[model samples]
Target: MNPIKLNLTGSPREIGIQHGRALYEQIRSQISIYESMFQYTSKISWSDVRDIAKEFKSPLQSLVPHIYSEMEGIAEGAELDIFDIVALNCRSEIALGRFSDGCTALSWKKSNNARVLSQNWDWTATVKNNLAMVSIEQIGKPTIYMVTEAGIVGKIGFNSAGVGTCLNAIRAKPMISSKLPIHVALRLCLESTSVGSAVKTLESLGGVASAQHILVSDSTQSLGLELSPVGNKYLTEDASGLIAHSNHFIENHYVEEPPWLSGSPIRLDRIRYLAHELIANGVSGDTITPGLLRERIFSDTYNAPQAICCKEDESRHISTRSSSLFNIVMNLNSEAPSAEVVFGRVGSGEEGPVLKMPWV
Candidate 1:
């Protein structure tokens, strides 16, 4: 089935109330899923997770109160505790590099000047039922069309302003609750008018809670921001105007210990190879489009189970098995900014229906 679709507008609180009322059951499912994931991955109970979530309350309210208000709305709308919503927003931070979610993301500026950003979001298949496609309309912020988990405020998607974002989770250390959470950072990017403005917002805030790599693209350009609590780094597109990142840190980072997720390097190399090959072909004559990328690059399963379009392995333990939950491709052209979200593994026969963005 396609993920639940929601169009939310009004004040932050009202929006949250609508979201909460509309997806109350899904939100509850999301909370239950995370409660188990936290215990299995981080060896922490849900109560402890809530306690960890409490640390970010003040920072969120002080730094980005609108989002905090929106989150509060979600909690109130769902008739759940605010901290429950906070825990969902802060899951990346609370997990502390213990969870396993492997994703491969890319941003390509085609010779035709079409800016494209996409990724295969890999995670445990259990959360699939709770996923959602959210379109948010607010007074000041750009209109947002994104694929997000039930309770989290921000995630992968593009805005009407022609700004788009893709996320690759990085599991590096020295998490600081005072900084913005990774998912919230993606929300801020969606709210931005330009890639430069998004970068400025993240930089000014002193980076995110933990480590994450966010690929930001607009009508003009695409760049990757590798954020960590200690410091942040910028990765510009190559001369070919292509930037690809997997779970691991691509550039030298703030710490000596590199983040580890099995098969990350292999998946990175595989996708890069396929992308360059497609670019070469495109240079000769083949036009590159979101459909082409989905079929060629993301559909690849060169190394079963651990491939770019990941699949769960029966041999692996239930807690460790991960698959590509969805694939999203955005064409960020000022003339017509659009997105295509596929709810399951791209080429995996059982992939879900395709959902196009901007509603109309």
Candidate 2:
């Protein structure tokens, strides 16, 4: 399906209302699917989900009023209750064990002055049909473009400020509370004008419900942050100017090993090796175009269900029936930051036409 393009502006609530109404049916369908997934995976009922969603309201409104306003707008526009929308926003936290896997890489060359940030969003195959590309123009913020599931405010994308972000789910023992959830934090990151601001925005959230690896990049710099409910740490690129992360934590002494990180270690090593190999072969800067990156790296399906381009594995309890839902590559150095989204998985040999999103 063609991605829905939404140009939203005005007050926070107004922007959200426009977003919700424009994709109301898609939002409804997403909610239904998430509800079933929750029931089947965690045995959590709709009533419990609503109650849990309400728990984040006070913190969200007090800390990030704009995001709250957007959620309210989504509720009103989609004709669903405010708590229902909140449930969708916090689904990652609510359904902790069922999170997806991902791979992110950043590379640049001083000689040729080319740079790129790329990621493959691995998730439930069903989400492939529900994805949408949302372009948001809001007051007091840079224009943002994101590829997200309906009813979700953020995932992977870049902003007009030449800042881009990619996410990888991580697991840590004894989850705790924080001022904001990861999805909301993702929106905050995209709203940032620079890499420093993006890092500060995430650091400001003293605690988080779950763990995540937020890979952020700007025209000149790239950072990989490991955030958990307890604390956060970060890693920068080595001499090769290559930084990559999968679903597991790589920072030193962050937390106990996440038991749910199935195939994470292998995938992490594989992606890191591939990225370095490309760097050694002079695939950096403009030389590392999106198609070349896809063809050389993401198209590798060596490990079947656990490869860089993941295939479905029904037997796995965590990512049961999950595959690469989308692939995105961003040119952070461009005058108008832009991204290319491949709607389906890259390695499956069925990737859809590339959708170019030039900054507005």
Candidate 3:
């Protein structure tokens, strides 16, 4: 399916208004899905969603005014309350209160000295049709090209400054918080001009509301940041110049695991094994192109629904009836900064059409 594209510019509110108006229907659809999921999974009423969202309003406004403006614009355009938009942006934190097991991200330096980042966003099938690709151009910030659900401002993507990022949902004991949400943190990372700046941006947040793993890289370096409500830690590349993260923490001492992540350990082990095997079998950076990365590694259905490229299975205990929303592979070393996004899962021996961004 073709994803909606929103090319927005100007002040944060203006940009957000344009985004919300242009994708108003999609945003509405997303809200509906979230509402249903919250009801079914957490028994959370919309009233409570709004109330929880309100608690963060002051903090969000103080920490990121531009994002607040953008969210305000979204609310205005979508004809929804500002708190609704805030709730959507904080979906990770709220939803994690009930369920948490989705998303996978990896970053590695190519043998040719280039850097690449890849991720598979696995989520409830409800918003499958509500996804969009957004390009945000701000006056003094790095241009952001991200793939996100409607209404929510940020999820995954890279920037024009050669900095790229991918996100994975992680769980911590007592998951909810009142600090910066993961989605907002993601936008902050995309706004960063470099890897260091991105790390610093996250570090500056002091704390966040939920646990998340951010796989970030630039032309020069790659790192994985595990963020929690209490503290954060950095996970650097291993001796093989590769780092992969799933729904659970590999840096065990850094955080505690939520109970619903039984499949996380398997997924993490599979990715690490595959990555190392690829390198050991002579799949060097020169051979690890975007297509290969998607088809060979991310698409592996070794364990069915729990594989790197997940599929929905109703029988599984930890399944969310989720499928791959999209697989994004970015070449951070590209002169103009580019990415390849394949909507939906990459089936066995089936190569789907890959959409290249910033059309050459």
- The most accurate candidate by TM-score is 1
Model 3: lowest-lDDT 10 consecutive positions: 316-325
lDDT of 1 at 159: 95
Model 2 error, position 115 (Å): 3.4
lDDT of 3 by residue, 1-360 (tens): 778878989999999899889988998887787787778778888779888888889888888888998999999988889988998998778776465447777887884447888989888767878988889999999889989888887778898987888988876754545578988888988999888998888777666788788888888789898878766778888888888888876664545665676677788888888888888888877687888888678888887777788877777433256777789988887466789998888765443478887653
| Candidate 2 wrong stretches, greater than 4 Å | 100-114, 316-319
| Tens-digit lDDT track of model 2 for 40-121 | 8888887798898888888888888888999899889989899988989888778774655555444443332234778888
Compared with the true structure, all predictions reach lDDT values of: 0.87, 0.77, 0.81
Q: Output the number of the lDDT-best candidate.
A: 1
Provide the TM-score for each candidate, comma-separated. 0.97, 0.94, 0.94
Q: Write the per-residue lDDT of candidate 1 for residues 1-360, one digit (tens) a residue.
A: 757889999998898888888889999998888888887877889999999999999999999999999999999989999999999999988987777888899988864546889999998898899888899999988999999988889999999889999998887788899999999999999999999999999888777899888999997789889888887788998877788998888774694446477688998889889988976775422266768888999989988788899989888667767899999999887777898889888877888777799766
Clashes of each: 0, 3, 0
CA error at residue 155 for candidate 3, angstroms: 1.2
What ranking emerges by lDDT with the best candidate at the front? 1, 3, 2
True-structure RMSD, every candidate? 1.5, 2.1, 2.0
Order candidates by TM-score, high to low.
Answer: 1, 3, 2
